[model samples]
Target: MLGDMILRAFRLTVRVSAVVQSSCQCPALHSCRALHSSPVLWAGHNKWSKVKDIKIPKDAARARMIAKYTMMIRIAVREGGANPEFNVALAQLLEQCRNKNLPKATIEGAIKGAKSKQGAQYLYEASGPGGCMLLIEVLTDNNTRSHQEIKRIMVKHGGALCEGARRNFDRKGVVAASRDGISSEKALELAIEAGAEDVQETEDEEEKPILQFICDITSMKAVRSALESLGVHTLSAGLEFVSHTPSLLNHAQLETASTLLEALNDCPDVVRVWDNIHAQNSQGN
Candidate 1:
């Protein structure tokens, strides 16, 4: 009986040792197997995951941009007229819509809706970071709801609503044209003849030069027509609120302001956001 008992004790010790050894070796074994096996597949999956993360936001942004442009087109038609040729704003907006690759059917529907006066236009003003002024344009069927939603978004982003914010900015008609086919001198001459108040040339994201013509709101149609008659095709032409007193923001302040503007713009009813922050590049109309 004593010999059997000692044998049983030895077996128990051996079993415990085996368990400890397995516990220690399991992690290393898994690591080795993972290293020797299909790391390429894992890497490919990780890469695809990263691409998906990047693309989903971009696709959503594109969709939002399309929707905003559609709303702008509709508003333009409603305020001016449905006929693009007769309504300069609508004509310019349609050009921009085409440039953005908005669907033809969607554009037509917006025009029809606008002709029926289906929505109300709104302008919201706010004070942003770095003492910048913000002008948010919105169009919706419900003014009260849009106003509340916009105010909420602004306040959430450390901004507050302001009244009569247009007093801080100058309303002007802006026309953006590419410098692809014409010389700067010729573009300037045409713009001046068209009653443009200012002519500035700047490069786009592609480093291609773009010529911008600023004119009185009353002269937008004339300026556009004159440029077109001279064989100068404009990229965009619309009304803009030019800051009377532009504010310069430091890097940190600029970042904060940009974030606030983006948040405001993401609101579905927001058509365009105008700010007083000085920027090297001008936004599309």
Candidate 2:
């Protein structure tokens, strides 16, 4: 159903706008001052947007792997047990690492490092225009480095660190799982039975159906355990800020917003970036 619809939609769009323009017009950059100052541009089709969109999924998957490894180390230490034989979340995260083809050496290093780590860490926070809350997750040994990097990026993109950005997002346990063989009806049923407060279909264009579940932080372990018991494979199970309502961005602003998201996400300290940005756009503060 989706593939046919996508093909039809693509056909309609391609038919309407067929004019191909090069990103760089001037062939001689040395003569043109504007061209000389500006970044290099590739000639021909404006298919970079499509390519960028495709790249996002791959980037997200890589970022998730990094976060997963970081989390595994933290979990191992917090549990006061380096062995996954006892700690379940650590065990689960390790399983995820294996599935992603992450190196066993990386996994072992995380476990070992966590055992030697000590003390509490700084948690950075930020909010975009219109209260689009962002939680900057980091595990760096240097707080200053993480802060400076995130602060620079956020300010550059019309966003700033908030005094209490954490308050904007409900302190709930958020989990993402793919629909392997289970039907949507059955998944929702299992989720609710497992104490999920709400389930939302994620905005993903992939083979598997993505579902987001919300639950109180305290009940998170139980919820995960319940779902796992039912044999439902969860892609990711972690905490997140669930938006009450997404802030809609205008078509003009959306381009910049996406760019900002990309820049912010590229930073190593930035583990997760959440926005309330919705589909509707209204002007003013």
lDDT per residue for candidate 2 within 108-134, as digits (tens), equals 777877757643445667777544666
Deviation from native of the Cα of residue 200 in model 1, angstroms: 6.0
Q: Report the C-alpha lDDT of model 1 over 1-285, residue by residue, as the tens digit.
A: 999999999999999999789968789877776787788779899998987998777788778878887898888887788998899789888888787678999889888877676688888888877677888999988889999998887777777898766778999998888787777788778877878987777653234688888899888878988888877878888888877787776677778887888787788888998877875333311
lDDT of model 1 at residue 229? 83
How many residue pairs clash in model 2?
Answer: 3
Off by over 4 Å in 2: 1-64, 71-80, 85-89, 115-120, 181-190, 203-209, 221-231, 244-246, 252-254, 281-285
In TM-score terms, which candidate is top? 1
Reference-based TM-score of each model? 0.71, 0.62
lDDT of each: 0.82, 0.68
- As a TM-score, model 2 comes out at 0.62
Best by lDDT: 1
